[model samples]
Target: MNYKRLLLCLLTGYTFAASPASAFQALQPLHEYDKVSKELVETLEGIHYNRPNIDDAISSKAFDYYIDALDPSKSFFLQSDIDSLTQYQNSFDDALRNGDVQVAYTIYNVYLERLEKRLLDLQEHLPEMVKGFDYTLDETLNTDPDKQTWATTDAELDDYWRKRLKNRALTLKINGESEEKILTMLERRYKNQLRQVDQTNATDVYQTFANAITSALDPHTSYFAPRASETFNINMSLSLEGIGAVLQMDDDYTKVVRLIPGGPAATQSDLSPNDRIIAVGQEGAPMVDVVGMRLDDVVDMIRGESDTTVVLEITSSKGDTQTSKRISIVRKKVKLEDQSAKKEVVDIERDGKTYKVGVITLPTFYSDFAAIQAGDKDYKSSTRDTKTLIDELRKENITALILDLRNNGGGSLQEANALTGLFIPAGPTVQIRDQSGRVTPLGDTDATITYSGPMAVLINRMSASASEIVAGAMQDYGRALILGDQSFGKGTVQVLQDLDKGQLKITQAKFYRVSGESTQHKGVMPDIAFPSLIDKETIGESALDNPLIWDKIHETRYPVYWNIPAYLPVLEPRHAARMAKDPNFVAINAQISDFKQQVETYKTVSLNEKTRIEQQETNKANELLRENTRRKALGLDTLTSVDDIEPIDEDTFAKEASEILLDFIATNQLAQQQAEKKTAQN
Candidate 1:
């Protein structure tokens, strides 16, 4: 069988057959789970990458992951509890295989007890701390506790929790909420959190343990519970019925992060970033206050069958206060039109001539699978839409093209292959290596070149998966000059497997560039790396725990643009010169410096109101100075304060990439002229 089809069978065929007695009879002391545990443990040992020996060392790691999944930041479980639980570290694998999960349940039960006690402590102690604490004092609390030690004493934990509560209060007070409202918010939040924790079921424990086991293999490998699996599929197919806005927990409030490109929320335009969803309800149902609800719970309430309406009570901050708005949105299928390839032309003056540089911003590498399956002749996809945009841009007499993949997280592996086919005279685009070390060259064997003009690709740290594939292929073939920051390094391939109880997303393959270079930890480097807001140390595959290490294999033979090395010499220096003088880049450098300082010098902020306000005003002043620097460079009106500067509607990076495209044309044009001159002289 061919590689892809082989993977399809092997990956999706993973299922656990159960006996009549396989069901759990009790909450703890798992003697009854012998059959289920044996099956799961055996499946993982045999099928997972490396066929990991689940001995004491790996068992210890699994235990660590399981415990950490429940409590990262060392927020719960005191040192004594941790010391008591350390005995089970080397016993999990044996227990998992032998069907003795009493230890797992014991740990979980203890955690639950700790959680209950903590909540009760908070309920009693929060108001006392908020009322008694001297807010005018110069005290500080370290917010991030990634490497913090576990609380040695209950009194020590109480001190930590007191600061946490005080910080929460201070944040709201600064946001113009009265002490009464803040107290109410905190009470509701603590109560809801307690309620949610108390409601954890057996299914939740199993799923949590399953994920701990799987994620120990790799960060991407995960076990999705039935409801979660359904959600994942719905998202992947992009056929879910909901008012499509991505939401996140901002303190106690469910905040609208962003509307999906062509969803009902985006079309409505009433919802926005930083807007808090205070309440939600269905048509004819009483409005439920969702102010302190869990993000997932809020999402479950928001998503419904098609044509159904969800009313959201939103509040956006105005200066130091909040203003409310009621927005009703009808759920519908997400429209892919907005995410499709969009074309723009930028004119840049260089060397006494203006070059019309074409820009195509690809939001995602998507394919309308449903339409394709239904045998529609004109199914929507990245390659198809890109081809159309290129044709249109050619009609505009563009000199070069910039494929903007700045925020493209990538989708559809086939689309990446097809999109690369549009630029090159067809060769291997990517190499896939399966579990058996079998190498498969997934390429565009067809010899079709859609666009042969000078080209550049714009990518950032967010450009990942299929985006990396396309960019890697182009870079390998010398088809395009890759610009911007290094792309996200996610080269491992995974397939979703259906289990009896849940779904297991397991890494099955690794993707290699046509040049035999792997993009696992080391992503595709740019011809000209741009200053980025995303830090390499914080993001990318390398940052993830247990990521696949990069390695090279024998590269597939292919022709490439050999003149790229010679062409780059002139362009690099010219671009660097421009950037040194460019206002936008100067502003970016300053911001990057400020961001670096914030990350490095993370000293605790003073609780004193005057110092806090003064610091905030200073931050605003710096922000305004940076904005005005860019405005002065662009010859726009210089704003006096941060409030005067309007929201940036333009893609500043894309515009700069377009300018770089002009440089590409200029450099190539000069090279061609010199070639002709040398030939003429001969």
Candidate 2:
């Protein structure tokens, strides 16, 4: 079937049910098995993939999911496609049951050929195909204004990408360098740097193809070939045996964005964000040129058994270049507890009175899915962990609590609901409506309330999904004050549907707060808004290309809790007055303005001279340090050098939020006391 025709049928024939309650009943486990069997056969036979054993295993799993999703009972798949796809089921089963690698490989090759042809056809019609498309690729490459070039046409984009790919390939092949010579050079270069160099051409091609496919899908989803997959799993499990740093390909150079605390890099205290990696080596070995290499391949070279030594040649964000300096440390698991929420008591002394505030920083709403599925009694969920922390804070006489949800992408819906229950009384937390107009009311069954004091939620553009839910619910109920920049604005709910044996996460429904407002395109707006340093114009769902439109649904029933007046007559003026006098706020605003100017003037530097580039980088770093020192002198925390500000801790910002909440609470209490006095006098 043609792609367009199949999509049309699926869209028209499938109905989005009202709620999971009614729709879930129709889904049967047996139907899932049947669908799985069929998809597995078709995928194997049609694709003609090589490596039958791996193909069958993957396809079988993909089919199970595909069937479950298409099963009208469980999902909204079109019946016609389901019926047509089923015809190949037996063939897939036969291939899998027989372990036919050749057949699988053949199927895969055929599919790949078709895909290539389609892509080429699209390229031929590029100009017409992308007519009126408004999206622009993020200009992350240009750091200097004069060297920047923008492409607005599809043809231009296609040509640009093609050239980029070709250039990368040339770098890998060393430009007409003989295979034997190339291998020799690579081995000598990385002899001391890497454990081994897997210089196979096949490995390079596979990685390139995988990267291309993943880029086409989205920025997040990626295909990690066997060895790469093992590395990824290790990282996810927080059990890396090397320096704790996440690396990614950003143009020609591999950039470091995160440094896991307590890791070798973090302990060394030399490596910083945006630092370019130039060469790598181990003890008594020559440095290898890692520039222009695939990120995964470079990563493989970096990882090793614990307590082993590796040398890294790094170019600091500033103009200074440095060698490894022989920093060594024992590699240990990045304990999940390291990523867990941490509580701190921030005492704010204002007008001769000390106000004790509790600040809780939640990095991510992570849960042990494996343990949960296994029905482990002690499965760790965010809600349970947060509840324990809240109890501890309450005992310490915390008058207000600041729930810092910055950079928290989100996790399970069950935990979102449970966390919401902690703030508000037992009630409907959110409404989930599928395509069929069925609405499922997910509520909090727990009767206990954790913190009932003044509360404020700190979020930025990165906070999304379950984080949005909790923020939206708290705002709707007037139970907490929402502060910080606009949220990530992801209100859609994705359900992972198993395709034959593979997995497909589809946007099955839209989420609405108890008050019936969808947090889709319009994220939860803060009651008291603050300017953020990050660029919101380039972030969030609204900034995405071809994103789903924002809309609303019928309201759900929930009791109105707090009735805080919108017009905080004295509150706004008081905040304005305070901000005017606050040097920290003034400095923050200035820094934000400077960053905006810098971003606007961004261009690519073309200097081939190392000395010139080094000087420029040094100057820029010095300027940044000077600006940071100035801000610090103005009552903000001071950093002596740029290295002091390695990984940004949004906790300081969260503390600022807690102070704002305290101001609001104090003003409200004062007003209430005045009203009571007036009544008594009358």
Candidate 3:
């Protein structure tokens, strides 16, 4: 049969014998044969992915499956690959069953060679296929093979097989060796790994293949497995079980990306972003070594029921090992309100006068799609919530407003439009273009302007998507003075298209500001940029392994422009004067510098002597925190203790943002007074 036809046949009518009774069901005879046939068919046909037939499809599939087999806990492989590879599953069983090591080695070598070649092809083709490709995988393959090093050549493969047999023999030495004894040991290890496969979850496999296809087409397009979908829902809703931290596997370690406020990890007073999880242990179970494991498998191990304890043995970037005390936290459903825009009033004393500036902390631009689709009465959304907050701030008669969007990873397009509309009069907010060259305008639906007085927006590398939209609109219209580091350049818009049984989050369009500048790879640059504490050595779209390049479209017509020549010239000098004396800013820059150095050094740490390396990391973190506290005190925002540095309302970036806005407003007011005096004199 032709490859395409074979794939269609396999997909259309494939079914397992039945769901296993428990997580520990043994592999049935002939089941292996059935799986191998399906895999071989899929491999030849190339129909496993949503947008298949790409050159990388076969290689991507091989890499994915091989990774899955090695680290079953966090592997991202399709159910099809598992089912197809089943025929070869009994290769180990048959060899050990009949005391045939040579046969087993030969079978493993064939699969291993195919996988290695495929990975090499994937690495070679990636740069040409994708723009701004970082070549991370290629670098990884060249630098380290870890356990996979044993399967490189025929001799190495034979040696690995021999070692496995020798290990089994050594274990049975005390008990005296029998064919059954060696076979049982091999079977137990194989079954233990297989049980972690989660065969029933087809969504897991489908999403991996789908994401690879979408990623190949463009970075914006993605596929979310059922678990990922659930996680997305939790993120959108602003809550999740287990540790309240975002994680990604970097090399062999699962590193902390971001920590959610009020979440167990954030509240624990010990867990930190950039910490590497080396091991994971459930209550009453031996800790499992998670080093060099796949991200998905690690995630599976970390997720559990509410109030259940999972110990995370972590190592810091500086190589300090710290065993986190078993923290007991009841996983509670976090509402959108909890993670939405939180407003506060900051009183700053400048030149013997008190200035009340309104600070609005926007954690994320979240929208409840389920409630909105159902037309519910109380659907919490970013635009709606912020509008209400703006009205309340206006009621308080605040002098100015600072919109804090630092670390916000973007959300709904509607919210971005509405939020921008609050500052600018009714007009086109942004323009979007599709793959087929179709242009669509997304405009402001509201007429009422909110907080038109002095405004400033805060952004950083993590501030992306909807955050970029709002910042871009505000800058384009001269509505708000942009502050902080460059924003995360993620302007692409994705639509979750529901298939018959699954869904595809395809990159349907690319968003551009009213001025026609695309926030693709080059994010929004701030008007008054502040040094960021977070290291950007490996952050944002530009820093990703493979990212799309920045592009622009025709400018959308919008009737808005702020003549800030007089204001900007004077604002720069005044802000420069304050920055010189700002101890907090000085300290923050130093910390940022230190962090960059640490990141550069961290890449070279050896896996051997992990315990000693981890200790150094802990010491570095504690010392940094202490220095930051001292700096904070010097600036009148001193944190008394490290514990006092609560994740709650305590954002140094946001705090500095209020001062930045105050400075901007002060400069503008001074310029306005001078202009009026000149008019009077004339």
**Candidates in descending TM-score order:** 1, 3, 2
User: In terms of TM-score, which candidate is strongest?
Assistant: 1
Q: Residue-wise lDDT of candidate 3 within 1-682, one digit each (tens)?
A: 1323422432211111122233322222222233332332333233222333434343344334434433333222233434554554334323222323233233233433343333333233222222221212111111112323323333333223333233323323322435544444444433333433434233343344334334445555554543555422212221466666778656446777666644666555466556777667787875565654556667777777767777776755322222222233444444555677788888778899887788888877778899989989788888788888989998988888989888788767787888888887789888887665677888987777876787888888788888898998888888788888888788776666544334555565677888899888888998877776555645677866446668878888876566544466766676667666665566555555666665554443222223323545554566557566645656546454443443323455565667767766767677779999999999
Q: What's model 2's lDDT at 476?
A: 80
Rank all candidate structures by their lDDT, best first, as comma-separated numbers. 1, 3, 2
The 0-to-1 C-alpha lDDT of every candidate, in the order given, reads 0.73, 0.55, 0.57
Instruction: Give stretches of model 3 more than 4 Å off.
Output: 1-212, 223-240, 244-263, 266-275, 282-286, 292-301, 305-309, 317-330, 368-379, 497-503, 564-580, 606-651, 680-682
Error of 2 at 111 (Å): 18
Comparing candidate 1 with candidate 2, which one achieves the higher TM-score? Answer: 1
lDDT for model 3: 0.57
Cα lDDT, model 3, residue 649: 30
Best by lDDT: 1
Give a tens-digit lDDT track for model 1, residues 283-356: 98755667556667778888899998988867642221122446788989876886788989888777798788
- TM of each candidate vs. truth: 0.85, 0.61, 0.67
Clashes of each: 0, 50, 21
Q: Which 10 consecutive residues of model 2 have the lowest summed lDDT?
A: 19-28
